[model samples]
Target chain A: MKRNPIGVLLALIAALALLASACGSDDGADSADEVDSGDTAESTSAESSASAGPLRVGIVAPSASNDLAFTQSIVDAVNAVAGDRELDIAVTDGTFIVEDAAAAIRGYAADGVDLVIAHGSQYGGPLQEIAPDFPDTAFAWGTAVDTFGLPNVAAYTVRADQGGYVNGTLAAQLSESGVLGVVGPIEVGDAKLYVDGFVAGAKAQDPNVTVNVNYIESFSDVALASEAATAHIQNGADVLTGTAQMVVGATGVAGPAGALWFGTQSNQTPLGPDFVVASQVYHWEVVLSEMMAEIDAGTFGGEVYTLTLENGGLVIEFNDGAGADSSVIDGAQATIDGIIDGSITTSDG
Target chain B: MWSDFFTTSVIVATLASAVRFATPFLLAALGEAVGQRSGVLNLGVEGVMLCGAFTAYYVRLNPSGWGWAGGMATAILAALAVGLCMGLLYAWMTLVMHAEQGISGIGIFLFGLGATDLLFQKQVGVPLPISGLRPIRIPLLGDIPHVGDILFNHNVLVYLAYVLVPVITLMVNRTTFGLNIRAVGETPEAADTLGVNVNLIRLGAILIGNALAALAGAALVMNTNIFQQNLTAGQGFIAVALVYFGAWRPGGVMAGALLFGLVSSTVLQLKTLGIVSGAASALTAMAPALLTIVVLVIVSRRIGQPSALTRPFDRNA
Candidate 1:
């Protein structure tokens, strides 16, 4: 049967639009909700008070809460910071779509949460728009410095390089091939900062060591990340370090090849015990707790919080399962102390 | 750094990576070629791939009581079944319901991506590792140094993808079914008048195409033993593009897949060897797609697409 081409095309477009809307954001929330610490509608008294009651905190992240990459870093930190202070935490993760994330941010702010952490750089713009409407609620977003200069918004940025440098220094020691590899997502924001710092520290540790870096240009292309790591291994790279969630792919290849893996953003020890020597864990709690304290002291958001080694915001967590020698641990600690003090200098780029 | 990239070892490693990379593309693009040959455009190849990859990974994560072989077989079958179901849906939309092929295919892709992500979240809350298939060394052939590693040291599915190219070529070129498909795709009115079932041929082609695409997704997830949302990435769409780049021939499709694989691998290798950096590496990464687009431009004028592609054929009309 010959159908009218134009009519069929119009009908398909209409059906697709409806289907697309139905399938898109609702699934994003359902997936993220599974990873949430608290049910979406559970504990809410329109007054978010950190001093008098448990601090009500809500998080909107771009990927899964346990992605073991960017999103996990903040989620882990928030959970950690809940110590001593009873914190009511809710998370809407896997909101990689900016618009969906924006909606989630607005919802949290409207709920009168004490702090709404938009845990993605892309959410910066959305936070900017949503913060002014909820002037009483403090909004924090990052790996970015921009707070839109809003009185009700705070910014948190990480010196991921502080940890990346330490990771690279350790990588240089663990590598027998003297050739290290990096599987990067995209060379922008924290990913780039981490890679640059890794290279600087590795080159500083062993000037002749070769660190081959491959930016697969995608954060979730696990297959490509695997191939990149394979290429590195095939070419004699015995130590691999990478950023972003896709490093799970790299870690998978590294374990079987007997190559040591160094991680960042979150403690990737759970990725595998065999390959993960150490990780540069982002302890956002240090910065976050400070922000919460400031808010409790009647200061709304006029400051930028930076996570640094000195501030105890970022720490090199040695995977005891990998079982590194004392010398390796001592060297990493020394590098950390140096970066913390004035001795060790890192490339900020 | 430049000298390191030019070494024979690096070259061999790059080629090996390229071959591994090409496996998924070949599986998907070859299936797409078959579907296009039958005058149907299944743009949802990517979506089907996502569903397939997730199904395979989820199944692989939960090992059945029947050991490694059984678990592996079950996962593969499950993924293939999902593909078949998706294909049936695509066929029903285009063939029975007479929906516009392009738009409906996209809808399928979006649905697959979203649905798999939802299933993954509900079934497996976090990304966990599984024991994926390991590379098998062919008896004597695997003993050869670099050449053996490149060709013989591959998983079963990798070998299957390469083997299917010729089998499909033979089926499409030599069989009566192939002839009927070509006739229906090219001259559906005459084929229908002569008692050929156009819809049946198209349906078969779509089902076969979708199954292969699903296998491609399965191969990707099995390689890593890890499943995330959109694990197949944009490989499905790339496979569709490769069909056109190959002028809809299975041989040409294989070449296109291999070419893309090599270029991508080579670019990655260059960066890995420290011979390329920064924006230059980014630009070089686009080589495969650029090369494909150039071929497409040349083929558009010289070659022919299936005459009745995307058009719903009605016997009454």
Candidate 2:
């Protein structure tokens, strides 16, 4: 077959066009009144000058909202907060490409959602752009580092590293190979920080611990994650931990091999019986509870909240099962309690 | 990494991987064989396979906690029904509406992906588990050296995959339906003039192809207890590629599937042994695909595709 130069050129042009579209952020702006119909349950009591209609909450997920771990937690949190009050919560899923996120935020703002919460760290830039457009609506985003808080948007998160550190300690003690493995979606700041914490925590538990870290480069590739775990296992890494949303593939590979596996987000003990040793779980209830309490107390505004062991934002659950038993759970619990009691402090302090 | 190859565990891992990889391809190919023999070229195999995988997982993982065997059966039947419906739909669209065959096949794929993803989100949330198929060791054969571990001690699907190859080969190369299918695919007008119910044969092919795709999906979920969103990961495409490798013959497809299985198993073995260093691991993972592309290039010259491949039959033509 003779290769067609024009066809190749057209294909290139099409690819370039797609890349350009995928690269740009959404710039469309929408007015608040156009979207929110006043019928949602409004607690007339929330401090942010309760509007005639119920609260309008918007959530933007850089990844799929169906992600049962991270994004799902935030969705559950919004649902919990909306459960009591007059609230209409709208969510846009699968916003990995930067521009789609901007469009989602603008659309939510136009809909007159009172509070806009962007779950992924990558949404920080777009959230900042749209927060100014909808000043009346409060904004809370989950960011790894210091939040560049805008007047309307506030960054809120916990010390994920702190919890990772505790879990790392557990993994180190359980690892027979002294080679521990960590699988994450991408090497972003948020994930990097977690890995750093895990390495530190592992070393703290046992000075000689060696940790191997690999990133799947995408959140959606479970097969890649499974292969990575198998490679790590083959390398004599007895314990495996992942920061991905669903640890099914990773756990599947690790469990059958009789290696220790740890999960992130929710307690995944149900995934593989006696496989997961510990999980760095985020208690969305704590964040939602605090937000609800503040809103009810008539004190809603842009405020960045950090939920750590001190405030119970994040906690580590060391698997108490006999087969996946770890003494490090006790040690980590003690450190957590000590931190809460002001006796122990991480570098963040 | 090479050390892993010599170890006892590596042998088990490779054996497991081969069985795992072969299950879906075997099922899909078996279905394709039925369709091809009936004189139809059903390109909607990928879509049907995905639908089967999703449906089977949902049935198995639903609150009842149906065992893996039940899940496989459900998946197989569901896929078969879907295949039957899709086959009828394709026949109606192509035979009645006279739409382009390639276009209709693409439409089927899009419909399957969207419908499955949406239904999965609404129904049985992600990460559904079926009582997975456990390995059963055959008495004397399972006790043999390295080969026994490779061939025996497989889940029911593995054995089925192995047994179905020859059964399908015999059924097609040796049966009346097989001749009818080949004739239909080659010269539809001639078959029609010969008093064959052209529509019936084509519809049967479509239904059978779809069911086989579904069984492929079932094998996938049964092997991996947990089902994630879009778990097939282009294995449907891989199965189609296998058809080309087998030169569209049952025996050829089976051999190609086993070859791909071995390639996959070898990669996993290398990873386990830490023999694949640094950037090589990524290459190792792609080994199966690369091997497939290479084999296809070499084999395409020897094997001729169906005369009416991808072409919807026209009464005038």
Compared with the real two-chain complex, what DockQ does model 2 have? 0.09
Looking at candidate 1 chain B, the ten consecutive residues that score lowest on lDDT are B61-70
Model 2 TM-score, 2 decimals = 0.76
Q: What lDDT score is found at residue A24 in candidate 1?
A: 38
**Which DockQ-derived CAPRI band holds candidate 2?**
incorrect
Distance from true location, Cα of A313 in model 2, Å = 2.7
**TM-score, one value per model:** 0.91, 0.76
Chain B TM-scores across candidates: 0.96, 0.90
Q: On residues B20-104, what C-alpha lDDT tens digit does candidate 1 reach at each position?
A: 8999899999999999988898888999999899988888887864466448888999899999999998888889878888988
- lDDT per residue, candidate 1, A34-73, as tens digits? 4333522232333345568877788888777778889888
Per-prediction backbone clash count: 3, 13
The runs of at least 3 residues in candidate 1 whose Cα sits more than 4 Å from the true structure, single-residue gaps closed, are A1-56, A82-90, A103-114, A125-134, B64-70, B143-145
Taking the tens digit of each residue's C-alpha lDDT, what string does model 2 give over B1-317?
36647777666666556666677887887777667655455566666766777766776676356555454466557656766676676677656555556656555555565556555655655463356567789999989876677778778877987888887777677877666677787877788898877666777667767777877777766666656655666677777778888888888888888888778766665644546634676656667889999999999988787776655666665
lDDT of each: 0.84, 0.66
